[model samples]
Target: MRYSRSFIHTQYEVPKEAETPSHVLLLRGSYIYPAAAGIYSLLPLGHRVAEKIKKIIREEMDGIDGLEVTMPVLNPAELWKATKRYFDIGPELFRFRDRRQREFVLAMTHEEIVTDIAKKFLRSYRDLPVMLYQIQTKVRDEARPRAGLLRVREFQMKDGYSFHPDFEDLDRYYPRIYNAYLRIFARCGLNAVPIEADTGIMGGTGSHEFMLESAHGEDQFVVCTQCDYRANTEKAVGLKPAVKDLSANPPAMASVATPGVKTIGDLMEFFQTTEDHFLKTVAYDADGRLVLAVVRGDFNISVTKLANHLKAVHVDLASEDLLERHGLFGGFLSPVGLKDKNLRVVVDTSVGHETLYIAGGNAVDVHLKNVLPGRDFPVTEQVDIAEVRSGDTCAQCASGRLDVRRGIELGHTFKLGTKYTAPDTMDVTFLGADGANHRVVMGCYGIGVERLMASAVEQWHDEAGIIWPVTIAPYQVILSTLGKSPEVDDAADALYEALRTRWEVLYDDRDESPGVKLKDADLLGIPLRVVVSQRGLKKGTFEVKVRRTGEVFFFGRDEIEAAVARIVADLSPSLDGLPLLPEMG
Candidate 1:
């Protein structure tokens, strides 16, 4: 591509609303333009990067015999209704009614639609195992979208689904896709770590997320240094400390009159005790029912875990009206002396049966002390709902302290079981060897092409600009004409022509100063840069530098082609060698 003919634009000043480095750099480099808070338009440069990532995904998907297919962006509400997602997906689903008054949805994922296809086509046992994939656009109504491509309302994704006869077959095929995901990220010039993750709205028994660690990432996850245990914070588990011995002499529970103290900090300061000594009870409205979620004051509740436990579509802190309706005070409510049978309670295991605690008095400006679980308050439905913190002991090995990092999700794979293929859902079936009907076990895999591109910049950029990985850089070589010397221009033109014949090269043929051209080259992050100047031509050499390492090399005009060949070979042998889509004959 020639620079003068391209629509590439660069900005000197960053946008005021840009928060993350990827957001600022993408805008300044003219790779993306903001359309709204959560929506963006990918410019030519951004489209090229997305295409590169898509090609890598296609290569890996095709290698695994994945049949490529395209599903509609607008899905019928009946399909989602069959899967119960039409109501369960909440406001994130883009739903509307058509002219005929039939409801429809813009799909966030295609599980129901894909399984419906399987139901219509696959009829025999021979079709028990099939993998179908598509590279298509998906839409979700993000409430608070930010971080550029990391959290967007609409974007392109490569989603794949596989069907199997039984759990054993899916178990065998799951690892194949897992390994393929690893290869895809590695070929894209990213170091993504696959960690155990909550399936969330994608209801599955198990799932894994490929995460690229970045300081500006929105998702928090934990990694074990001594072992292979890692998970998203929502699903992360840590060793439970031994319960404190409180049986020496059981103190009677007593209510104390305190004035103007509602928060845990104030209670801790008033009593001069650690946070864990107090029991924090939070009231929530889950599926229209008021429930109290109790945990240690030191830890915050994992809302995801709480919602998942209740199988609720949405959960939020109880409003003042809802709490008042249930005869519950906002900041002074505890499980003890609760007369409302409708008010349910879920306790965290961190508050054991014998552990004594300081709790709310169910009255304003009052608190109870020396209260014990199972004695003062019933211990019902205890689970692990507390957020894991840094320096906590690992749950699996119980030796290493858990280290947390922020990460962007690059890929997700789920063992969906029969969630989509159950008889009442999509109802997909196949004939067995004995001519008996059976449901298909399903698995889903997804990768956001643009998110992977953004994560690459987040992982690889330096102070100057994006340090593109050699495998997926927009162009392997950038040939620049430094000055107005006719001889230097002619030499650069010859080299550009020669290199374009065999390599993906970008020639800076615009009438710009050497400083501007070099700065733009760095911003674009081409892996290899070649400069043509009269001074270097007089020295029988042209300046060549590797963008990643900043190592400079001088090649005589006569030896220019050989030097480029050597450098390309050292960095990457051929564009063909990089993972790419199958040649369309």
Candidate 2:
């Protein structure tokens, strides 16, 4: 490809909306163009990189006995309705009416469509385990699409689903996909850490996410310092240190009049005590039902954990009207007098049993002292719903402390145990060896193609521009002809022809200055740059510069191809001796 004829445009100024490094460089380098607020069009350069990523993903998926198949992006609404996801997923799922007024939905995922296929085929025990995968487009009406491809409404994804005879078989086959995911990310020049994650909307028993730690990432996770325990904040758990009782001998609950003292901070200041001596209550509207969540003052509630506990589709803060209708106060709310109320009550495990603490008095400018759980108020439900923070004790090892970090999620794997294959759902079944029909267990794995591409840029770029890895770079080598001498031009043309036949070489045959050509080469992020200049040619040699290391080597006129081959070999990511999983303590 020649720069003069190619659709390549480099910008000098960054766009105002480009916040992350990948977003800024991709736009300035002309790799992607914003089509809408959350949609983008991949230019020629970006398309080439995407193709390379797809090729790598295909190879890895095929190695695991996965059969490639293309599912339609437009799916009938009846399939989703059968699976009950049509009503469970809210505005994020794109739904519309067709010409005949029939309902349809854009494919946010293919779980329902694939299960429908499995129901039609795979009749016996012999077809117990089968894997199907596809590299296709997915659509989600994201409310806040920011940071370029990292969070987009429409993007490319490689989603795979496997059906098995039983839970035992699915559990055994899960590690193969896990190891394959590690290799795929390593080959793409990313160090993604695997962490336990919540199965949001997927409705799975367990799941894990592959993440790359970065400050620009939107997801937060915690890592143990002494053990192998790691999890996303939405599902993370920590060992809470035991707290002593506020009072040695328990006293009866008593309410005191306090003027203008409503918040926990105000109560703490008025009593001159620590926050741990108080109880905090929060009200939420979980799927139109009022839920009062109680936790210790030192801890905060995790909304994801709360929603999962109630099995609700949508959870938001409860309105004042909703709370007042149930005779609950805004600033002073408690579960003391709500034992027979129509709403649900959830108490965090952090609120110790038989321990006296301060609590809401259920009246204006009033609070209760000597409040105890199971003695003064009914303990309806007790669960772990507090947010895990940095420096907390590790739940797995108990000796290690946790470090909270932010990262970008590159891939996810889920163990779905008959969630979509049950009789009430898709009804996908297979004949077992015992002459009985049984529901097929399932597992799903997905990798965001564009998100992976953008993550590579985020992980590898420097101050100059993007530093793409050799495996996924648009072109491996860039040949620039500096100066207007006929000899230099002829030499560069011959070298370009020799290299194009064997490798992906971009020839900068445009009439541009040396400074502009070199700057553009850096911005494009080709791994190797081969220069044929008048000064170097007169000295009976040419120059080769490595993009990653910034190392320069001078070679004879006839040594361009050999030097390039050797340098590219050294710059490539090696798969030799790669571990399937990280070392555990």
lDDT of each: 0.87, 0.91
Over 1-585, each residue of candidate 2 has an lDDT whose tens digit, in order, gives 998999999998999999999999999999999999879999999999999999999999999899999999999999999989999898999999999999999999999999999999979999879999999999999999999999999999999999999998888888889888988998898888999999999988999999999999999999999998989999999987767764577789998898988667789998787898788899999999999999988999999999999999899999999988888888888888774466788999899885678888888788898888888888979999899989999999999999999999999999988999999998888999999989899999999999999999999998889888999999999999989988998888888889998889999999999999999999989999999999998898889999999999999967877888898888888766654653222
Please give the RMSD of candidate 1 to the true structure.
Answer: 3.5
Per the 3 Å backbone cut-off, how many clashing residue pairs does candidate 2 have?
A: 0
State the lDDT of candidate 1 residue by residue for 112-190, as single tens digits: 8998899898888898789999999999999989989989999899999999998888888887888788889988888
Q: Output the lDDT of residue 314, model 2.
A: 90
Candidate 2: segments with Cα more than 4 A from true spot: 576-585
* Strongest candidate by lDDT: 2
Error of 1 at 551 (Å): 1.3
Candidate 1's TM-score: 0.96
Q: Judge candidate 1 at residue 424 and give its lDDT.
A: 75
Worst 10 residues of 1 by lDDT: 576-585
